[model samples]
Target: MSKAKKSIEVEITEKKAGNGKTVSEVYIGKQFLGNVREDDNKFLMTTAKNESFKVNSFDEGIQELIKEFHLHH
Candidate 1:
């Protein structure tokens, strides 16, 4: 019998703060992963298989990452 591989999925969001700062919110299966400052300019998310992604624009990057997760899983 073969074992099934686990799914590594996440979601990202770009939020604008009242102070005019932007933040990137990351989530994994409804759980909040963490948040990164917009000034960072780059965010990396990795899976157990060592596959990872580098996001530039938080908004667009989140959308594309979600799409990639769907296609990969």
Candidate 2:
């Protein structure tokens, strides 16, 4: 028998608010994942996951989610 591999699709969308600022929304399939807000070159990530941890960068967050997906598979 062989183990099955799990995969996840991350979709990111950027929108302009009434204040003329850009915000991003991230989605995993049909589920709402979270969003990221940036102000003056500062970035913040708000994700909805089973567990939470601090990641130094946005790429790290994506990597962590990939690892989590494989573990749950």
Candidate 3:
């Protein structure tokens, strides 16, 4: 028997929303995953999977998202 492989390839793109606010959108292949944005100097992330989180630093926000999604370095 052979072991099946499980994998995901993510991509991020930075752009401006309708309000001209900066946002970084995350994608897995061609599927939209989530997004991160800055608010009041803090970083926030929202996902299409019903996950939302906020942090005081941009780096922390990104790290938390990686943790939440179980992504490996």
Best by TM-score: 3
Q: How high is the lDDT of residue 1 in model 2?
A: 94
Q: Candidate 2's residue-wise lDDT over 1-73, tens digit each?
A: 9989766678878888778977666777876565555656555556556345555666665566555555665
Q: Give the CA lDDT, 0 to 100, for residue 26 in model 3.
A: 76
Local distance difference test values of all predictions, in order: 0.60, 0.63, 0.75
Candidate 2 vs candidate 3: which has greater TM-score? 3
Q: Which candidate model has the greater lDDT, 1 or 3?
A: 3
TM-scores across all candidates? Answer: 0.45, 0.58, 0.64
Across 1-73, the per-residue lDDT of candidate 3 in tens digits comes to: 9989987676888999898999988776776667889987888888667678887776666556656566633
Runs in model 3 deviating more than 4 A are 1-10, 28-31, 71-73
Q: Candidate 1: where are CA atoms >4 Å away?
A: 1-3, 39-73
Candidate order by TM-score, highest to lowest? 3, 2, 1
Each candidate's root-mean-square deviation in Å? 7.6, 3.9, 4.5
